[model samples]
Target: MFAYYLNKTLMHIFYKNAALTDYLKSINIQQTSIGFVPTMGALHQGHLSLMERSMLENEITVVSIFVNPTQFNNLEDLAKYPRTLDEDVKKIESLNPKIIIFAPNVEDIYDGKPSSESFDFDGLENQMEGKFRPGHFNGVGTVVQRLFEIVKPTNAYFGEKDFQQLQIIKKMVAKKNMGINVIGCQIFREPNKLAMSSRNELMSPNEKQEASLIYETLLNAKEKFETNSAHAVTDYVQKTFKKNTDFKLEYFQIADEVTLLPCLRKNKNKKYRAFIAVFINKIRLIDTISLN
Candidate 1:
């Protein structure tokens, strides 16, 4: 039957990892460059963009979807998070990627034991998302470090939407001498400009529509800088969202991209970004925009 052949074809094309070491050995012997994009399933346009870039630049692309439990500070949020693996696989197959999907049993990857290995980033983790959701970055860094060890990727792709996390991961790679290049991909958004996120799946119809405001507000904030509008910076963004009762504004401030320090001045040549985090229907959303 066509179904049988389809199943066989899908296995060969998408889910190709038989063993971690075996896959690595094959790539090494062939001298193929490996690119990785790690995600927590519920694949969205944002994740695909990373994979597309990896496919274009490297001979092999590997994506892992683990819904890392270690990364979530709230058990309820973790349970509510989406997981559409069957559909996610179809999406990956459409890319026709020279890709391997690493969906391992937790025991295989983490030995089914509680992970005591935690990393402290010297105050980097304490800022932004860290201030609100403590222990998040350590969970992020822990799984990412494990992935780096398993994949040993020549290059890895992450999104700028998680700007703080990206900075910390880059620091980990550098300080630990991991010998992996971490590239930050631009945030992919919908036509209405909501930054694409797996958590967006949990949003109600109205919540998703209202979530567009997060990005729109950042755009307006960026324009403030572009037009050299020196009036109260954070005050402007906070006041704009104050009208939206459905959303709880987390933080809306412009900061230097590299130093993660708030930008108190408007200089045309100075690189700056507008970062915003708001809760729509109790689901937290984060986004950033460059002020050019």
Candidate 2:
């Protein structure tokens, strides 16, 4: 069975603004410490883990599953992105937390108008995901900002798999000076060590095996990090993946964790990490590892 039981009592889904607001008001949400976990549907274990953490830390947990359209630079990718609302609701309900599922429609979120607010991440946008996917972070910022306004949660949870996105959201919260704490949870990985992602559903079994090489490469880089220079480690990873015909390596950056800037040379004072994006069977996958 997809879920142990369809516990309708635990899962409350809202598509309109008024109804959600009324319910939250009736429940006295303003008086409680609310934890918000925002997602783009196609729920996975990584999402569940975030919910579990939120539940442990806050009195009430709210999860939003709106696939923000503005985040997708490629129209086809946005179109192909998975949307399993029935299964997603089932998975969240299985957790048995009294969670509010805010699956708002585009019209409801945008209010029949477009989100035109621009965010300056101050060069955070010039890095990996931003450098390639133009205007992606803007969409992320817009939707997340909107959600935070609507939910008014005390704490927000995000997975570390999207490390850059996590940082961007934190930046957004800070810029807006919203009274909300942004928490970055650990990245959940599969048995083979490949970082779990909603996009994994598109991968065939053989393709999934090929994708594991991305993490394997990161592990290899981490080992080399102990003895090699940052530049040398990057070159090695690039050359190694170039030989593999299964996937095409987009970028492998060894960068400072906070600044998100590529490291010229390793500094013992600062923490460094390796971020990678690869195209496997036409689906783009990203993974990161601590080089230190």
Candidate 3:
């Protein structure tokens, strides 16, 4: 039947270590360059773009669709996080039937313990997102490190929308000497220039429309950053949000891209990015813009 072959084409999806392990063993690992794109499983254009890039650049591409519980600091968020495995699989199948999928459960990843292992990213974990969502980077580091161990991909792709987390992940890779190529991809945006996120699924039309200002404000801050101090730019972003009653500003900082420390004074030689978080109703959204 048509459904049988369709299902067979999707058989590359691995739910257990043995399935993925046996599949990988069939390939020539040393000779093949594997590209990995890991996601929490709401397949947006942003996620698909990463997978498309991986397929173009590598001999093989693997996409992991796991809703990482340890990564969520809030239990309610974990409960509300979207699980679109059926829809996600179809997207991956349409993208490339050959691309492998790793849809693991907590037991497969953490042996069911489900706790974050603390990591010292040289205080990189203490600032920005870590400052507000305590143990977030630790959950991130733990899950990512464990996934890396299990998947053993040659290169891993991450979006720059989570710019701070990307930097911390890079630091973790370097400190741990993982030897894998940690690649940072550009932030994928919506029609209104809002960075695409899984949390956007939880937003109402008005909330998403209002959330568009977050990126627009960040872009404005980036333009002002050329002639202004980081402190002034932060103030400008803060003032912009204060005028608008919709988005409650959480935190905003223009920081060194390498260190992620809020740069009060701009250093022309160093790379800096404007990072921001805001609460649009119950949904907390974060976005960043490069300030050269």
Residue-level lDDT of model 2, residues 173-194, one tens digit each, is 8987997999999999988889
lDDT tens digits, residue span 1-292, model 3: 0121355574477888777877777884577988999899988999999998999889989889999888888999999999998899888888888888898899888897999998999988888899899889889999899888878888999999998888888899999999888888998998888899999989998788878899889889989988988878888988998998877999998888888887977677999988899998789999998887
Compare the candidates by TM-score and give the number of the best one.
Answer: 3
lDDT of 1: 0.79
How well does candidate 3 score on lDDT at residue 174? 92
Q: Over the stretch 28-117, how does candidate 1's per-residue lDDT look in tens digits?
A: 756578899998889988999999999988887888878888778899998999988778777887776346777765665677774636
- Give each model's whole-structure lDDT: 0.79, 0.87, 0.87
lDDT of 2 at 146: 89
Candidate 3 weakest lDDT stretch, 10 residues: 1-10
Q: Estimate each model's TM-score.
A: 0.91, 0.95, 0.96
Q: What is the lDDT of residue 255 in candidate 3?
A: 84
Number of colliding residue pairs in each model: 0, 0, 0
For model 1, state the Cα shift of residue 125 in Å. 1.4
| TM-score for candidate 3 | 0.96
